[model samples]
Target: MQMRVSDEDRERTAQQLQHAFSEGRLNQLELEDRLEIALTAKTYGDLLGLVTDLPAEHAPPVPEVVELDSKNGNIKRSGDWSVPRRMRVTSKYGSVELDLSEAVIAHSVVEIELALDYGSAKIILPEGASVNVDAFRSDWGRTATSEVPGRPRPGHLSVVVSGKTKYGGLTVRYPRKRWFTH
Candidate 1:
């Protein structure tokens, strides 16, 4: 598929990350990790990768790519092969079935927008993945590091969530890096 990274996404990610870095919210390790993610991100998939390793309570809202016309997808660049796909995860929160992983992308580093209705959310990436997310106007997210994975480990568990949060919040966690972490 074909995807285009908008100037808005680029600018937004840069500013948020710059603010995080300036505010000492990220340690040296975290700073480097985000920078790597930012640099490696070309398509939306690479940008989405940046949000994979966060805690469940801080996932940003993902836009409704499904509603977009596919005509705007998969425009082959000089050397483009694959496009990013959606990974939707649904969960039962009390009585309502919430799509927790609706905005979830596997490997992205660009800027993402999330809509939150209740609590806070965040994203945890690898050694070199940076993400910037605006969760509406109320919810906020801070950086976190951990050794645990989010989704169920019965299979290759990749989790995702975005927009219209109803309960506690959202978080995405990347796997443990045998090599390095950011």
Candidate 2:
């Protein structure tokens, strides 16, 4: 009997392909070819072939991790970087900023652990992505966010900001695009 695939399965395959591309395992041409196959795959077996040779998501050697200390001054991470499963942000007298607009997220939800002391940190995300900063707080400073997103649809990526800070501030912004009428 022939099996069938759901829309969620297709999108999940596409996301996996994108993650492989970001990890430099797949070149643009290879990624495009695999994406085409994954999106149009009819059954689970077909989709499995596309990522069979790729690394298993569950057993990735180590989560991508970036760190900033007091000496690094203002820190910024942007462009086609892969969003690790877990990220640690430690700012002691320095500011840190991370932009996830063009990033390739490995998992459905990314976790960020923050530890700031007398410094500031900001996380900027593209529209459509969901972020939960509910577990964040500052002692002397404050936390500001544009707007918390409602429950995200399936296949939507999310980020969870947790941890605590003292004498530091945390800000989260989601920039929505506006189309102007001619």
Candidate 3:
């Protein structure tokens, strides 16, 4: 699925992250790592944790929760049954959290989508799971790519968003399973 981040939310998230880094709660490396992720977070929910680390002034609070049941499951049961992956977020505009541990698939496939309209957001994937992420960025032509456990495929898969958000121009698609788009 393709996720999105809002303009107003991104600005506020940066402020909050700076506060957390300055507060001594997050070391330089930790702050940098998390800050980078928060700043580029495509979904407002992705910034949830990053924002929470900052001072209260950075991120206020909001009340909301949205969940999407797994699309399908059917792969032959692996010897072990590990918990699915989980993702959570917190930021100035609001916060959102999710647990994918239960999203295990036996064989078939599952798809999900999220759009950032308010704050920050994040995604959690299982070890063997695969993902395709195309994020929207302001850089003239900066791009990122990496190899997760599973092979990357093509399909639409989006996520919940927050605050003054805009498309990074990037979108994620599914390969093995059904994918949702923003």
**CA deviation > 4 Å runs, candidate 1:** 53-61, 67-182
Candidate 2 matches the true fold with a TM-score of: 0.59
Write candidate 1's Cα lDDT for 1-182 as tens digits. Answer: 12455655545555556566676666778867776776555665555555445432222234434221212122111221221344222222221122222323443422223443334344444423332222323233332222335333332323333444444354444433467668
Clashes of 2: 0
Ten residues in a row with the worst lDDT in model 1? 74-83
Candidate that would win on lDDT:
2
lDDT of 3 by residue, 62-122 (tens): 3133233221221121222222122222222332233333443333233333333333223
Off by over 4 Å in 2: 1-72, 176-182
Q: Is candidate 2 or candidate 3 better by TM-score?
A: 2
Tell how far residue 91 is off in model 2, in angstroms: 1.1
Off by over 4 Å in 3: 1-3, 53-182
Clashing pairs in 2: none
